[model samples]
Target: HAAFRAGLVVCPLSPLYKQNELSYALKKANVKALLLPGCESKQSSINDFHGVFQKSELDEIKKNLKHLILIDGNNSIPNFQGFEVHFFDKLLENDGNLSEEAKNSVTSDDPAALFFTSGTTGKPKGALISHYHMSNNMKFALAKGLSLNGPVSVPLPLFHAFAGIGASVYPIKHYRPIVLNNFWFNIKSTVESIVKYNCVEFWGVPTMVFNLCEYIEATNTKIDSLQKILMGGSPVYESLIKKVKRLIPSIKELSIAYGSTEFGSFVTQTGINDSEEIALKTVGQVADHVSLKIVDPITKKIVKIGEQGEIWVKGYCRMLGYYEDEEKTREVIDQSGWYNMGDLGVLDENGYLKIIGRTKEMIIRGGINLFPKEIEDVINTHPNVAEAYVCGVPSEKLGEEVCAW
Candidate 1:
């Protein structure tokens, strides 16, 4: 919030990132200043950041980085050569206010935040999100029923785009109070917080929701306050959906969202009024001001409804581009502004999207394309099977063989 008020772009890095990953991200983003936690809590310590500064790969970062602001630190700060160290609290105590001209200089189109992709495909790429993109995304979510009804519980890490933009930014923009969990997710603590705060809305990944439901079922805990849920960052299977509805009878809305970091978190989400079947099978319809199409990856042509193809989206929520990587940006975004989502899916007659699988993760066996999600879905139906993962392995006769675990 202070960064935005001062018209500076904010880039949040995951605390779990190793030294190499941290150095790479900082140098790649050309970070000029770094603000991180000091030796204040069990989650973080000043020694955790020593590796980042010691790495030789941070030559670029060392050159550009000028301020090393620690959230809570003593005066006995280590002398980082060529860097100025300051305590965050002491800086806040000073009355150095930004002028109106400085605040107003930041326009809606200007980059407000930089979020990195999860690097599941390869190396992480930074995506620049504009003020307009985030603001409109919040508006779209609110219009779809994620509003100021009650306190929202955010158990997911704030560094991720889903939690940062959807769970945090949206609530702040809409004046919705939020209950934030500082440390990693714990089922007991999460449940306690929700019940203690009477949180009505919950945001998390499908795995988190599944664990919460499992804990609730085992303990016979009743959380009557939770009314709305938004789960994303991965596929939401039917089994999980059934568990949620059965375990949490008070939940009036169980929305499943689908989007990428480049799309400012959520592009399509299930509505509160959607039927049980729709909620279980699809990722709902596209958000307002967004255009979606199914494109044949080979021919680069639009496919008919119900035909499986790559998903392409264009809208106000699209990121300006990958930060400082125009070559990679051009590879994903086309001339017409449509961004290739890189996920294979089918659009139903009713315009609902059902994600098939990632294009890169598709298995080819003896010239036949196989989506692992389909096999995993079938396996998960067995009463004994809790979960399953399917992949392709090299085969002598066939090009590839289906491997499951």
Candidate 2:
């Protein structure tokens, strides 16, 4: 909120990131100031940076980084050599005012935030998200019927796009209260917080939601206040959906969404009134003001309806290219403004999308194409199977063989 008010591009970094990852992101984005925890645990980020970077690398980072703003007031400030160190509270003591020139200088098209992709397949790329993208995406979410009944519980980390923009920014934009879990997700703490705060909506990834439901079923915990749950960040299997509905009968809506950091927020989401089968199988219809088309990965042509192909998105939700990486950006986004989603999926005639698997993760065995997600979905249906993952392994006879675990 402070960054937005000040018209600064805020880049929220994950606390779990190590020094090398941190250095790369900081340097990549040319970050001028950094605000992080001062000291709460023995292995604080401040203390952990002691010997992680070489002197040359540290010197290069310090050139652009001007300030190290520590959040904790009680703890003594750590010496960040060659950089100006300041306490967060001390900066807040000044009069909160923005100059008219500063206010007018920031335009809606200007970058407002830099979110790094998860880098599952390669090194992380900093996504430049503009103010218009963030505001427009949230407005679409509200129009699509995201519940604002009461306080929303967010157990997922705020660094990721699913939790950061979807769970946090959406509520803040609508003037709704949010109950955010500061620490890592714990089933007991999540349930206690929801019940204690009377939170009507909850947001998390599929794994977190599954564990919460598992714990609730095991302990017979009842959270009557939780009426809606929005799960994403990964594929939500049918078994998990059934388990959630069976364990938490009070839940009125269980929505599954699909999106990425580049899109700023979810481009597709199931509605509260959607049928059980739609909620369990598809990721609902595409959001308003957005264009969705599935294309053949090789042909670069739109596939017939209900055929499987790579997903492509184009709209206000798309990011303003990657931060200073035009080569990589050009590879995904085309001249027509369509951004290749990299994931393979099938769009039914109803416009509902079913994700097949990542394009890079596809396996071709002796002229046969196999999708890991398709195989894993079947394996996950077994009663004894908690989770399943499928990958390709080198084969002597065949080009590649499917391997499941």
lDDT of 2 by residue, 51-138 (tens): 3432226777986888878766456756567777888788989898889988788888998888899888689998988888887787
Q: What digit string (tens of lDDT, one per residue) describes model 1 on residues 33-147?
A: 8876554334454235644555546557787778888765444576577788888788989887889899789899999899989888789999999988887788775477544
| TM-score between candidate 1 and the true structure | 0.95
lDDT for position 2 in model 1: 74
The TM-score values for the models, in the order shown, are 0.95, 0.95
Which number leads on lDDT? 1
Runs of candidate 2 with Cα error greater than 4 angstroms are: 39-56
lDDT of each: 0.84, 0.82
- Per-residue lDDT of 163 in model 1: 79
Q: Find the 10 residues in a row with the least total lDDT in model 2.
A: 47-56
